[model samples]
Target chain A: MVKVTCPICGGKLDIPEDSLPGELFEHEDCGAHLELVINEGRFELKLAEEIAEDWGQ
Target chain B: MRIGLAYDLIRWEEKALAYTIKDLGHTLELIHVPESVFYLTEPTIRGLDVTFERCVSFYRALASSLTLEAQGVFVVNTFDVIRNCGDKMLTTAVLAKKGVPVPRTMIAFDKVRALEAAKTIGYPVVVKPIYGSWGRMIAKADDESSLLDILDFRENMPSPHFQIHYIQEFIRKPGRDIRAYYLWGEVPVAIYRVSRNWKTNTALGARAEPANLDESTKELVIKAGEAMGSGVLGVDLMEDEDGRIVVSEVNAVVEFKNTVRVTGYDLPRKIVSSTVEALKA
Candidate 1:
């Protein structure tokens, strides 16, 4: 179990490695959508708000 | 090297590939694909060793066969990615689910739900066919009556009808959108598609001009392509009202005549190189 801290609200949550690629899981506490990016030997956590804001900008 | 170019012969873009292949000293076999191949069903799949009954299935079959048969098969924007990108509803859902930036979009199964969703999203929404390309069947509903008229027209259509989820919000610059061309996950060239009309597609007679790519735009294009799992993609983007670059659509196999004219890049050579690498892998 890997614990992920939400970038938006700074809340903590656990995510399994078997979670679907590109799946958007919301933070239970803040309702902030979180995304998982997987690459070679690297994992990145992204906030949904950032995606929305980046595209809007 | 021998390369198999698979596309419908009726499409003008296919000729572009042939020209490029000939220029690169490669033997190109132009395989004409039928529309029925894309919409194959059980009844259509009789007496074959393999049966492709769905659009996705057909795409996979085509890709797998080419990948196996050719020494360096360049499937110009692969069929799997094309199948996914061609469906607006599916593409929107997948992008949104994957945390990609798109407009406020919704899909409805029927006309009533579509109308309600349109109203909820507000006026000036763009209604598109679920499987449309080149900006066909796209209607801008500015009021309730226009929305209703579109729905009524759609409902009265012949077989295989579905209500598309329209998008409403932050109308961007008209007749201006960016097309970032990627080959093997790297963007070699980009173009700004400009038009006097609402649609910014070469097929719609839009003019193409060279565009400079900033780091942010490049990053966004790469991210959008990665999200869609397409190695080669044309990431269509537009700046919204807030100047944020929102992804409009992602094309797996993009026509590059206009892009090449603008950027002066040898697109087919790049694609062939990528195809060789992919096949080796």
Candidate 2:
């Protein structure tokens, strides 16, 4: 597990070793959804895209 | 086999599908749609056996599927399925033509004719954007005043897509609606999106519970799938005031994560395996 801080809230999140890039993890404490991204060889967390009007099932 | 997964946003469904495909020992390529540029002359997606179209946005899903399909990649939920299900009008027409029961719907191009159509369908009708989901931009107009108010807002929208009214009869449902997973020819699992609000979309706080599909529902769902040209589909059904099951809409790029959670069904695995079977065929 890799430890990272929630960018939206200062809470901790544990990313699984098998977690792939573009997979989403929710910060339960802050109720924010974060995306797992690999930037410059390091895995980082960023807020997921807001639901756009065209986004649907 | 080499498989491609085309997606705009990675949700639980996408991730589950990706993991499932990997677990099945298939070579998986993630086609990030936002960054991947498709050239009309040159096919970028070469050597992939099949591509599962998982784009949440209808436009992105259709555009990517068209390009990928033209490149000779067999897209799950082909270009036709994406195009038909992306627009409610097209979905309704396809279902109705196939003898599948759908809510009475009328299309109008302008506000005046829209009101006329609404009056014909009777008041308290549901106005929907032809191309939307998750219950967004859906308004129930109880009377002329309410409908006018709704139409006025749409009249000024920048996109003409909003102006093209797709009005449907608001079925007096039993405080819930059905969302069934139609894969290829089978209805694997279904859930009742129960909500106090009239809009029963899971995205809008509707609680999901496992639903038992009767033979009639299973048949209807399968028929609807056939009408839509097959793939992974989410068929939304609602019981009308007269207790008849009617198809509310069909989603080509259906999300199954919630259905899996609520029912404990291995939908992602099923989807991956089924997609592989489709590839072989």
Interface RMSD per candidate: 15.8, 1.4
Which portions of model 2 show Cα errors greater than 4 Å? A2-14, A25-34, A45-47
Query: Chain A TM-score per candidate?
Result: 0.63, 0.82
- The numbered model that scores best in TM-score is 2
**Candidate 1 clash pair list:** A56-B244, A57-B243, A57-B244, B106-B165
RMSD each, Å: 21.8, 2.2
Q: Give candidate 1 misplaced runs (Cα > 4 Å).
A: A1-57, B10-12, B22-27, B34-76, B163-170
Q: Candidates' DockQ values?
A: 0.01, 0.64
List, residue by residue over B114-199, the lDDT tens digit for candidate 2: 98999999978999998888899999999999999999999999988997988999899999999998988888899999999999
What's model 2's overall lDDT?
0.89
Which model scores highest in lDDT?
2
Candidate 1 structure quality by residue, lDDT tens digits, B147-187: 78887777776636344445444365756889897666687
Candidate 1 chain B worst ten-residue window by lDDT: B47-56
Q: After best superposition, candidate 2 residue B29: deviation in angstroms?
A: 1.4
Instruction: Give the TM-score of chain B in candidate 2.
Output: 0.98
